[model samples]
Target: MTYTGEVTVGGPPDTREAGDLQITKIAVGPMANNAYLLRCALTGEQVLIDAADEAPRLLELIGDGGLARVVTTHRHGDHWQALSAVVEATGAETVAGEDDADELPVPVDVRVRTGARVRVGSCELEVIEIVGHTPGSIVLAYDDPDGITHLFTGDSLFPGGVGRTWSPDDFIRLVNDVETKIFDRFDDDTWFYPGHGDDSTLGAERASVPDWRARGW
Candidate 1:
């Protein structure tokens, strides 16, 4: 089946193969948080993004391969609900944005900033920090050798607009950062996986940038 980037709490995850990497997305928790499991095809090394919930289910997906690291996109409770459990089970190193690292349940082993790189076997994911939804919410970009770029956006971005912000200034900051750092740098074919709900391409949502900005959300 094709990777639709759509999942529900009780359904099987959707996966896509990109070059040497395999990307699996599953939904968990009552909030319906999306958790991504990235596996390197070359070395079988795996890295998980957001241990949102359902530790047993996540572990089942991991199987016997074991996990190397778990990257929390933000400090939100829903995003890290199973962080402690998952890390304890796999002994995987914890990674999070520098500003939000201390807020997580586990001690973050890697506090990354923009431009930092996280490796999974021979594959690498570039980090891009977007502030507004949280002080240090981040998005990970993977430049697939055989395909287009793929982004794992936390609560910082969604299909229709940026993440929820408490203030007008925050909304503006998020929009500007998303536009300059993400939209400007990536192509229209870039596929983005959000923290919740479904995924979308930059081209599909490009024209709505002005509308999202105008609404100030």
Candidate 2:
């Protein structure tokens, strides 16, 4: 039921939980990168979104979620500096885009790309490749049981504004893509959780897209 590429240092088979999808955030490393643990409601199977640092805390939270996977939205060490420690906890598979697989901080067990789904029990996630902040950056979207779309934007979109392109060309492309691709897809009320800061909705960002573009941030 899961894609197993090369054998990696860690990975646990997916285990189903009998509750609801639960999301927990643990701030890791000096940068305060938010590491998220998503537990499937139907199956306790869980996935760690990031593992920057603070191994002790991350482990404590994932105590029994049967952590099966570690996923990185981009190549930044800030997003997965604690790869070794997390792997020890779950022996879980690691996933990232094929484009940047070679550059991954740790070995990858799964290489995913646009339109592919990463499933956890009854929950299925749609991957949206957003390549401005990092060459292999992605935004994960899933429809909760409530039918609400939730976006785990990684370092992509954020409250008040979008992520700054590390380069000029990346910035222009990132901005344009947000308008033409993302905004056109999600409803205004969809919730967004960036790699950092407060969560916001697509509508709020859409209303300010013009201003954001004009300010050139």
Q: Give the number of the best model, judged by lDDT.
A: 1
TM-score for each predicted model, relative to the true structure = 0.99, 0.86
Model 1: residue 85 alpha-carbon error in angstroms: 0.3
For each candidate in the order shown, give its overall lDDT on alpha carbons.
0.94, 0.73
Give the per-residue lDDT of model 1 (tens digit) for 7-44: 99989999999999999999997899999999999999
Tens digits of per-residue lDDT, candidate 2, 136-217, equal 8888887775656778888878887778776778887777777776888889877766786556789777888888788774
In model 1, the runs with Cα more than 4 Å from the true position are none
Tell me the lDDT of model 2 at 4.
20
The TM-score of predicted model 2 comes to: 0.86
Clash pairs detected, candidate 2: 10-91, 11-91, 11-92, 15-45, 16-43, 16-44, 17-43, 17-44, 19-41, 20-41
